[model samples]
Target: MSPAKSRHLNPKKLIRSKWTSASPRNKEKHFIVTNIIQPESKDLPIDLIELEAVYSGRSFALSWRELTNTQDWLQGWR
Candidate 1:
């Protein structure tokens, strides 16, 4: 596997992790992982996660890999 593919990501551990968007919408920069949508079977990989805006109580779903993009998302709140 390539370096990125070899990297380990524990989906169950992602819950409650904080995040910050590089480009804030409606001035909401801070967010948290509120929910992790798991696959129907454990053998399947995780595909989506729900992020809640700390300032607005808004939530949205996104592909988990999007969080790995430093240009778009910082791992912790900033």
Candidate 2:
């Protein structure tokens, strides 16, 4: 099998972005970037973000880099 195609993501522009899970569970396929977790130290880069499910209004924190893995996530609603 070929390698999964990954999406190019810019962490600075992730807020309010839309996404679709490749393998959705509990019918929570659509999601939006609700918030970007601020780093405790100014020198630290952004590493986490909050994703809110459109179907269930559930929110959770996740590594921003995980969105780059197209095998698990798509850039927009699909």
Candidate 3:
């Protein structure tokens, strides 16, 4: 059976949440939310999400909406 749809999430609550990439790169598939980049100005909105690779200790930022795409990301460690 196909996996369930990823949830409509709140970025503010995603700190420390785990994620798994649908496709592995350099055998690194596991990741975790390390930080939710704070909006620099009150007039701005948060748009970037930070994740750390559990395998390599490398961190990167991406659009938070990308997490909702099941084709590229899974909701938990898998």
lDDT for each candidate structure: 0.84, 0.94, 0.89
Pairs that collide in candidate 2 are: none
Summarize candidate 3's per-residue lDDT along 1-78 as a digit string, tens digits.
Answer: 787477698988889999999998987899999999988897887788899999999999988989988989998999
Per-candidate TM-score against the hidden true structure: 0.82, 0.93, 0.87
| Whole-model lDDT, model 3 | 0.89
Error of 1 at 35 (Å): 0.7
Candidate 1 per-residue C-alpha lDDT over 29-69 given as tens digits, one digit per residue, 9 for 90 to 100? 99999999988998998999999999999999988877876
lDDT of 2 at 19: 96
Of models 2 and 3, which has the larger lDDT? 2
Q: Which is better, 1 or 3, measured by TM-score?
A: 3
Q: By TM-score, how accurate is candidate 2?
A: 0.93
Worst lDDT window (10 residues) for model 3? 1-10
